[model samples]
Target chain A: MISEEEVKHIAKLARLGLTDKEVGKFQKELSSILDYFEKLKKIDVSDVEPSSRSFAAENVLRRDEIKEEQSKRNRKLLELAPETKDGYLKVKPIIKFS
Target chain B: MEIKELTIKQAHDGLKKKEFSAAELCKSYLDRISKKNREIFSFLEISEDLAMNQAKEVDEMISSKKEMPLLAGIPCGIKDNMLVEGLKCTAASKILKNYTAPYDATVTKKLKAQNALILGKTNLDEFAMGASTEHSAFGPTKNPNDLSRVPGGSSGGSAAAVAADLSIFALGSDTGGSIRQPSSFCGTVGLKPTYGAVSPYGLIAFASSLDQIGPITKTVEDCKMVFDAIKGKDELDSTSVELSKIAQAKYDLRNVRIGVPKEYFVKGIDPEVEKIIKSAIKKYEDNGVKIEEVSLPHTEYALPCYYIIAPSEASANLARYDGIKYGMSNAGSPASKLLDVYLSTREEGFGPEVRRRIMLGTYALSSGYYDAYYLKAQKVRTRVIDDFNKVFKKVDALFTPVSPILPFKIGEKIEDPLSMYLVDIYTVSVNLAGLPALSMPCGKAGKLPVGLQIIGKRFEEDKILEIGKLYEHF
Candidate 1:
């Protein structure tokens, strides 16, 4: 079972500001969740292939063609934005300038 | 006839006879939306004028004696997760609440090619994270059958809209039974096409590999039409497969085998669900199809494996929402750091369940637990797939309850994440095996609906569709 401290650490890593009440609530919830997952330990999945997709057809081929995206036609696309500057939208800058 | 109740086929025939102009039909749907969507909350935004204009174009094409598009003027609701050019694609999250899509998803492009009138985007659990639409930052969509009950989700809005006849059909993305369960709850036919049968180019990523775009309609025939229009290879999505070229199934039940896993019929399954399923099995027996009780001993492992794998993929797919690329930007940050912008943007943008899943996923994928959890889950996933393959060799298709229980009260399982996760138990294994599945309204448990699932071998959509259509007829 995962500890409350570990849950809190994960919450921080996930950038969530949880109330102590929420953290405590989630601790019990996550423990039960992990305990239920313990059922997987009993199953033997050897010799099985992990399918990445459901369709059997492979090499989904398309004619190689280059097409220009119509960037000029839809200026209304960005009109709903709360902020924009010089063809690029400006908001609180996301990346650290350092 | 009420415009919303008519099937796409019926609507197409109506257009051919010029009984009602496409604009008139669009107006009918709009009228219904204005009347009902306020309470149902099925639609986040409805483009009445835009839909009518598009419908007028379809009318013109019909009058010109031109070839009609398959879904011409058939109104469809797009789940908010899918990007429709110039429309809001918020995925029911505040983070991108007002975000307009820069481009259309390939599925949307295909639907548009058929001149399908897109009515509006439907709400969903934020980023399609939760089973119930309760996690939506916008607000929860109340089930049309019972206002106090939930429309199973994160595709709840789409299912509810279709169930209430708000739209003739709708598009929903299924990541761990989102499409199927909601379809079950809403009493609509929902098909989660073989993964990659439909392109995912414009669907805002939520567990990419498991995510599939499909139709929630009134019937399996409608599903077949929508599937035909949308299924194909697309250059935009490397994962989209060329399914049209695949061979159609030999449609006969005489030699076919249907696998009914014993694990699916065990405790915790509501008696009403079992009653409806037993009746469906009887129909298969009446059709002279063989039914053998099979074993998927690893059935219990599916929930854990799905949680681990889906969230792990979700963590990777959702990494794009870092405030800079797209969506709501965090302004007036308490901290001047870029990481702060990222954290606060996500924290504010995502709803509770989404945040919880992300944190759980991040921890599972963390260095210390990577091998012990994520890798171990992958190994188990392989086993689950093996179990299906071994069973499939003996059975032509598989059958299970779409969900273990009927749609619960709006707040029933929301507080309990495990209970919420348990709802997907029967549906997730199909995804794990990467096989096609269909959910058709078999019967109702009191006022709530139950879906009978038909699982097909990889790329055997035709077989599944045939069986689903047969069962639907019965």
Candidate 2:
């Protein structure tokens, strides 16, 4: 079962801004859903390996040689930014100092 | 009078014989969309200009007597999620409302190479999250079969478009029955090719591991044609594999072996749907195909396991939608702290179901719960895959219902998330196990349609498609 505080914590971790109504709604709803998940307790999965992917394929890697050609999607990618100045996207500074 | 309701084969034949110009075919579909889309709400955006231009080029190729591709000049609807260069690709979410694709998705590139005419972008559950199209940020797609009922979703619009003859075929991304369930409801054919048989480079990511882009078409032949045109490996999608070299063999319906999973015919399934599926299996049995009762013992665990794994991948895949990237951004908010930007933008941009999944996934993958939830789900996932592998060794394929019930009214299950999640029970296991599956209308429950699903081995879409074609005519 999920607690109200845990719901708030998960919402924050998910970067969602939940109103009081949403918080209350998700609090009740998420618990019921987790209750449904309680069915998983029946399986003895102690020795079973986790399947990270659906089917297996080797991860093919390319040689680490940088081709000097500029990406063709640069202009499009930059345009998708909320705020772009010339060729760069502006962002808030991290690690604020006193 | 109307050039509507033609299959892909017929459309191709007409173009080859010069019975109708590609422009005429394109115009007929665009005209149908203009008239019927007002009610069905199957499309979000119809690009008349682009479709006509593409049709004109096909006309030139036809006039020049060039070797024509199978789908050349054929008009189809694209699910709003897959990108088309210069066309709006919203994934039916408000976040990407004004965003136009900068490049074609691999499937889009394939469709373009054939000079196919794309009618428009179809509506969907926002980010392919919900079972019904009611979750679309725009609005729900009405079932053309019965306007009040929902066209099963998140590929509802694509299915409805094909069912209503708005397009010869449509493309839909199946992440946990998004494509198959909807096609079942709409009384059309939908195929989810093996996980990696088709390239995912351009189809917008939902749950990376389970999502596959496949066709929702009027007929099995069209589904096969569309699959052939779109499936192949690509450098852009690392998970994509070369289309398996299938041995050329005719799958005689009489010789095919089908496993009927007893777990699928459970109490929760609508009695009418169960009756239809039982009769379909009986028909297969009568027709000489070996029919055996099979136990997919872990199927009861599939729904919860999928709810865990899909959302976990979705949480990571969707992290890119933060205000700084290409989609909608509320960075201009009064609370301009970078964190506030992400919170505000996402909270405002995403629909309710999206937010719910994100929160659930964030919780599941969190530090302490990771081993208990996500890891356990994956382990169960291994069990699901093993179940299918063991069954396939005994039978060539499995037969089941696509959805457990008929298409309900739009608002019926939207309020009840668990009930809505239960809608995909019969289809989700295939996605979890990463196998190829197809959904076709078997019979009508009353006024609504019931779907028959045939699932095959990991890369054996051909075997299923061959048998599917036989059953389509049955």
Candidate 3:
């Protein structure tokens, strides 16, 4: 079973601030789910190669030229941001001024 | 006109004959949505203005005596996870509640090119995580056939909308049975096209490797029309490929070989659902089609394998929702630090199931657990793919029940996440192998509909559609 500390650690890793109640709920739920997932260990995969995708695909490259319409679309996207200034998205202060 | 009984083809014919103007048809659907949508909650946002404007364009084209596409003026719904420029695309999550789409999804662009009327966006699970739409932050979409039961999900609203005739056709995305399972429960025809068949650009990322956008319609022919319109290579999505590049073979319906995996018909399935599926296959045999019992031994491991691979991919894909770019943000609250902003915004934005999945994914991909869980799951996935490859050598397609049970009650399995995951047992293997599969209503178990799943080889949508058409006539 997953412990309370482990639950809190996972929530932090996922960048979700869970309440005390949610922590307890996830502790039980995650433990039960992980127990269910233990079924995978029974399969012998020693000789198998891991597959990340169902189909094999090659990398596709395109020209690096910029299009005028894309810049206009980028402006519209910036407008969706909560805070923006001078055609750029504004965010919380990263460096402290102490 | 009875709007509920109209199919896409019928609507096209009616428009061509001037039996009804495109605006008239669009208004009919908008009126129906306004009246019935409140009860089922299938639509999250109704785009009445957009629908009317598109319909007017179709009318202008017709009056000008210009040739029109089959989808011209046919009103449809897009699953909320896909973007429709300038429309509210919340993805049924509070995080995106106020988020308006900045651009059109590739599928939306294709449909717009054909002049298909955009009725609105439908609801889905938050971030397309859960099997039932009950996890939708907006509210659950009840089954049209039986309001007390669930219309299966993450595509629940799309399937329910089509089943309720709120829209003639709708687009849905499938990741580990999101499309096919819900289509089974709702009694609508749904197709999960081969992965990379349709471009994924503009779709809200869930599990990038497994996610596929498909069509949910009232009939197989309508499903095919929508598939043809939205499929092909796109520069925006590198994985996208042209269907013509794949070789195609012609097969007479009578000479086709179909395999029924013995693993799917085992004990946990409802006896009534099994009986219905078996009878449907018997009908094909009666028509001189060859039916064989095949073994896909790794079928049982698919769900466990999917749980790992999908969540691992989802963890990386969803990491972009860090409260900086767009959507909801808590930038300068009690704590003005960037980390604090991410924590507070996500805590308030995500729903319970979404949080649970995000945590599960993060844990699986974290240090010390990667090789054991994620790597092991991917290896099992290779076995699952190998099983399909070996079986396809002997059969043209495979037939199975879409779900083990019928449309379950609304609150039946929501409390138990494991039980909810079991609902996808019969459908996830197809997605794991990146194959095309169709879900069509075969018969009924009591009042609930049972769907027969026709699964085809990778890029063999034509074969499955042909097989689905044969069953439609029977």
Across all candidates, the chain A TM-score values are 0.60, 0.82, 0.93
TM match of model 1 to true structure? 0.93
Candidates sorted by TM-score, descending order?
A: 3, 2, 1
Tens digits of per-residue lDDT, candidate 1, B8-105, equal 99999998888888888888888899999999999998877668878989989988989997799999899999988888888898888878887788
Ten-residue region with minimum lDDT total, candidate 3 chain B: B329-338
Over the stretch B291-398, how does candidate 2's per-residue lDDT look in tens digits? 999999999999999999999999988898888877899986677588988888898899999988998899899989999899999999999999998998888999
Give the winner by DockQ: 2 or 3. Answer: 3
Quality of model 2 by C-alpha lDDT: 0.90
RMSD of 3: 1.1
Candidate 1 at B142: error in angstroms? 1.6
Error of 1 at B294 (Å): 1.6
Which ten contiguous residues of candidate 2 chain B have the minimum total lDDT? B244-253
| Candidates ranked, most accurate by DockQ first | 3, 2, 1
**What Cα-based lDDT does every candidate model obtain?**
0.84, 0.90, 0.92
Candidate 3, residues B1-474, lDDT tens digits: the string is 655568999999999999999999999899999999999999999999999999999999999989999999999999999999999999899999999999999999999999999999999999888888999998999999999999999999999999988999999999988888889999989999999999999999999889999999999999999999999999899989998888888778778999999999998999999999999999999988899999999999999889888887887887777778888888757775788899999999998888888888899988999888998988999999999999999999999999999898999999999899888899888888999999999998777888999999999998899999998887
lDDT of 3 by residue, A1-98 (tens): 88899999988889898999998999998888899899998899989999999988799999999999999999999988888889888877778789
lDDT of 1 at B106: 90
